[model samples]
Target: MTTETVAQALLDAQVAWAINRLTGDELPELAAKAVDDVLAIAESTTMSSLADPELIKSIARTIAATVPPSTAASTLVEHSAEVVLSNPAGTYTLREVVDRDHVERITDEALGLTPLVEKVLDDLTHSPMTAAIASRFVGRIVNDVVAGNRAMAEKIPGVGSLVSFGTKAAGKAIGKTGEQFEAFFGDTAAKGAEFAMGRLNKIIIATLKDPATRDAVLEVFDLYADKPIGRLDKVLSLDDAKRIGGLGQDVVITAAASEPVLKLVDALIDGFFTVYGESPAAELLDELDITRDILVEYAVAGAPRVFAAAQESGELDRVVREQLSPFFSSSEVAAILEGR
Candidate 1:
């Protein structure tokens, strides 16, 4: 699925959210409803450019005239995941018997959201809140991809739906929606959240060991010499702010910020930018090698804590406030609160 696919799903779910809030248990039924509505909308969208506003308005009028609101017209969302993953008897093939090699491929897709999540964390200039929110957003997105991939990957002996129904049906049912879902089910972080996590986690560990993904992550860490600005100085972009608001910051940040060793290198970029302004970019480039070593130390020893001399009378505020405080305090804690 592309951006459109996800966006449409999100839209349908939002509408479902409004409805499901009426009764908590209505979520699955509402999800089923949302899935049906989405399919119908998808069907209508195929013959028209519903992607365009004018076309959507035109279709809206046509629908208003031709289709009256009712049980069918009120609409429900349908998920092909259930239909695809299940055999005619409706048993899940993945749990019953998984193809080890194909399983490996699906695993890669699930863990693939990390770098993207880490990048958002590293780039947001002044927003701990946003960084956190983006982490959770990317987590769900990646999880969905895992579900889709797993649903498609598991071959139940004779079925041929490309994406398996049993897999995604199970994945979505595990409560991967929002804060309540995450709180109750533990989402992606929990090792036993779902069968998908088992496969997804194995792939993540494998990706960590893979020379390519590992090197890429390490390379990002190598760039961690940039200083970080204070909370107000955080230079959050409009897009990032919107996305962060769209998702909860704490959940996103907690999950996303857990990038094994990559978080350190990524932090260095923020820590350094906070320390030195853009004017030092050239000088920083010169010390790139040293920076890489320091970043590695950051990964190993963690962000450095400024000493009493650095923070006592606010020495950090004097010359290094933006650069090192809050990140690693004199007490050796630097996970400062960011954002306004």
Candidate 2:
């Protein structure tokens, strides 16, 4: 045969061999060997060398920019809601989803953020608006009490006139005193409000730190765990779901494009790299609980379906031939064939 004919024959034979190996009982062995080879390569390669930070950031930006249609978002939300509503609440109980130890750990971690909480409370309590609100709240309570007293006094026999006159005098005096106090000692009143707020903060912090707080959380979880999940569509109409989905998508798009969020994404990537950059890819996979056996198992399980689909679409032979033809048709191969 001519050199080209021999090359074609060799390519055909190789493709046939590959297809047989991939589709036959030897598939599992082939998959295992492939995984082993990959693992061997991964054992020497660092994660940092494989991942390009700029490329990842570019991909994120591209995804953020490509906003799906509102209808698509709505459909996604509808499907997700349907899936969620189909399952009973008992399908995922607190114990099944997370252990008590995890809950305790999370609670402890939250408690460790007391300084951030304190700063937020300090800002809220010390605001001028807070003092004004406190003053209004106190005034409302006083008015309510006075109104109650007046109503009780009116219900009594022959004491209504006397009590009404006394109450009016007391109310006028109280109002005048309040006005005078506000006019002269506004700063002192604000300080008092701030002091009350500080006390309130202490109470809140103490409540959060209490062991009962954890118990209360657990109790709430216990109460919810057994309850059946309600049909979300009953409460949230399709229109509402669509609107919320659109709004959420818009928010995500905006946030993803924002400088702060982009910086945060970069920071997270950098943090991951800082921790795992020098680690071998195989070690990283091991750390992630993905063993070689797991990889091989998944590959063997998934490859058949994928290969079947490709074969059905008539792409398998084309792809195989495309890959093997290059080697078979190379100058060195042709020269060797000519010599033969």
TM-score of each: 0.18, 0.73
Q: Show pairs that collide, candidate 2.
A: none
Which ten contiguous residues of candidate 1 have the minimum total lDDT?
A: 331-340
**What are the lDDT figures for the candidates, one per model?**
0.44, 0.79
lDDT, candidate 1, residue 188? 41
Model 2 misplaced stretches (Cα beyond 4 Å): 60-78, 88-115, 125-231
RMSD of 2: 4.7
Q: What is the lDDT for 167 in model 1?
A: 55
lDDT of 2: 0.79
RMSD of each: 35.5, 4.7
**lDDT tens digits, residues 233-291, model 1?**
13554445444443443343344434543345445544544554333333443455444
